[model samples]
Target: MAANAISPVAARWIRAWLILLGLLVYATILVGGATRLTDSGLSITEWQPVKGALPPLDEASWLAEFDKYRETTQYKLQNHGMSLAEFQFIYWWEWGHRQLGRFIGLVAVIGLAVFAARRWLGGGLGWKLLGLVALGGLQGAIGWWMVASGMGDTDRVSVAPYRLMTHFSLALLILCVITWLWLSLRGAPRAAAPEGRRTSILLLALVFMQMAAGALVAGLDAGRSYNDWPLMAGELVPSHYIQGDLGIRSLFEGRAATQFNHRVLAYVLWGLSLWAAWRYWGGALARPFAVLAALVSAQALWGILTLLNAAPLTLALVHQGLGVIVTLAAVYLVWRAAAPATPSPVQE
Candidate 1:
């Protein structure tokens, strides 16, 4: 082995740890969706990095936290009469979301430290691990930034849709990088199919863009606004989608318009996935291509059901969770298309 290259065994351990971290990030996204859906994101008004790990431990502490929440615009305007027990319910969700984030960071840091101390991380792996940690820290700051956007006295009932999208997009980017790195470490290098790789990359980008649009839908609580399928507000396209001078801005700010955009994007992606399935048929990429099509089609159905049912908690969470799966499937196709085609005995 090259002197600077990571050992096969050490690389395996690092990849396993990264895969675990990626899964944790996925879980965090699901919990975050729940937090937003349940209107629990702003239950804790302050962002205490170290001290906040311990949730309200007793009655006094609980009251103090609730008092802070009461001062928020959301609590005053939306949940004015909510009880302490009810507050606790939401509080736990938000706390758990934050706690899971902290745990992921801790695991990354500890793993990096252990591997470095043992000189197990080589071939730029240490730098990759460090970069992941840095990105995680930035994400935490962005999380608080998103939460603070909605806490102002004159702010909207929820976080700004742009910030919400930024936060969600960052999470997806981190997950993609981690997953790509993990897959890169697996098996051996193979020759990339240029045309197939190009198409897969486009598909992956579109999936990400669709997820961002979905974030806007979640941020604006737009999913519950129109509960019909194939049409919105009794029209093929909504009529009152524009409220102000900026008709383009309405896509992000207007509930009807946002939901409309999300629906259209879904249709486009669904069509594209079907095309991918056909293009990759009877090839090495057939299985992942099929999975991508199935997942996207299922996700589209779930989205419609969620909207028709007013985004019920369980269905909504599942809908959001499926986005991660679909994104990863697209990513898997991209990886396979780009990877070197050298045959390796350890191929998974």
Candidate 2:
């Protein structure tokens, strides 16, 4: 018996498909942020995975959906007096978000099916695609879970920040996997020195942690609370960071503490990015390292502008998008650093 194998051309096409899927996921993140910022996630009020993709096609359907939303705490507490037209505005954002997720899942299933039918899934290709499908399914559940957190609680208008963070973190995890696989399929470069690889890995971890902190900041609406950059509420450190019941919980639940920690982490990440670029200046990973430095610097500026401007929609979206870009840069750096020492000839 012979081992099943795909041609190089087929593999390239599959990788290209994965890249496109990855971009779609990135777009989903941007849209997701917009939905959250606009308070649209809870507008749907129900999770209909199969039937929900079509959305409300007529006035009657729209009214029915709006009626369901009226029952949610988000509508009662935060969106009271929201007219039907205003309700539609948010409905579309959440609907489109779900539709996109469905489309991504559809595309993944179709890609895997077509590849398998053609015997193009070889060398663990099938398992990889299956794993992504599983993750995508989990993300859908997480999305609903996040929204459900705020649904019945009349005291809360937004989903728990921690749940929102978990949703975003999983999305990033999926993105990172897709990105690394795509980079690996492109062509393996000569591996970096052992010390360089270790440092790059460390940088990647720090960047991820910083993004999680940003999630907490978003969850707590901490950015809106402190409009000052270099200082928060007219001080280097606000008077009361530990105002919550538990000392440790303040780090995650307290707005002031979360925002303060996010700022501190951003500065630390910036410093580390500079060091990464310096360390890799003459190595194979130099390009990615430099790109990471530039991205982190721009991200810092964006964060400040978004903060000083009170996180206006446009700037806040840009800030979130740049955070994704920075993460991609870090992932690329790690990928390059971890490549085996033997280089494949750069393909055309």
Candidate 3:
């Protein structure tokens, strides 16, 4: 509202909207974690944008669905004869997850319409917005892909590990892009990143990879297995978790060894980030690197605590939620460090 503040151009407005969308996505992810913990992810079993809104209007419909749930292995082995109230409890978390997703899609559509109409968005902004819209639509398809993993299988009623990781990765990808666009709009670009700061961008990529691995750990329920501290399974590095499987299956297996790998990776990431921070401290990169290091350290501690506490819903969700925030901060650092290509000059 102040002069020279430059009313947010449509491009900037869309970017700001995306940052909010990113927050909402992370909140939904937290709810999704709850849904898994409560064993409610498959409660609905069907994707209905309109029809699903009406939940079992009468007793007959409710019992019919309850009976179907009973047929599943989860009910027979785990929840045997679960009460209607108990079922309803888990149902709400999953339903809320879906509803939140619906809300995100709605907001994106509205924002796209309003921004385009005003011509406030310019250059590549329009095309990029279209790409983002497509990705958002694809996210829904992936959500169902994850749900379908559990629906058709009897051994597990939960989503597949790879699919779970992929879903979370997309969410982070969207968040990072939106954050960068917003920074660009706000004139947050560095006039010139101090020399040798380029490695900070490399560090950002490594941090994101570490995060994807973290998601896999969550998906496979791997955290609950590797509870030992300082050393995994009594040894400085447990050798058993990694030796059991071959190729990628080994990565997703709910074994202490696989979880141990995640542990070691976290430490490696921690040390690398600390070194990066030190390098930054003496130069122009100091501020962002120090901030990134602080976030990662806090995140690592939260991660260890979740493992020690047996992955309670609250602790686990917080770890997952903070993963997004910290990752975005690292992205901002990377954008500042990397220089874009500019026009070339010629001599006559």
What 10-residue stretch in candidate 2 is worst by lDDT? 339-348
Which residue runs of candidate 3 sit more than 4 Å off their true CA positions? 1-12, 54-58, 194-197, 243-248, 341-348
Clashing pairs in 2: none
Model 3, span 223-254: residue lDDT tens: 77768787776888666655444545676755
**Which is better, 1 or 2, measured by TM-score?**
1
Q: How many clashing pairs per prediction, in order?
A: 5, 0, 1
**Ranked candidates, highest lDDT first:** 1, 2, 3
**Per-model TM against the reference:** 0.95, 0.94, 0.89
The numbered model that scores best in lDDT is 1
2 versus 3: better lDDT goes to = 2
lDDT minimum window of 10 residues, candidate 1: 339-348
Would you list the C-alpha lDDT of every candidate in the order shown? 0.88, 0.85, 0.74
Give residue 87's error in model 1 in angstroms: 0.8
Better of 1 and 2 by lDDT: 1
Instruction: Output the better candidate (1/3) by lDDT.
Output: 1
Residue-by-residue lDDT tens digits, candidate 2, 204-314: 999999999998888878888889879988999987888857588888889999999999999999998898789779877778889989999999999998999888889
- Itemize residue pairs with steric clashes in candidate 1: 190-340, 190-341, 190-342, 191-340, 191-341
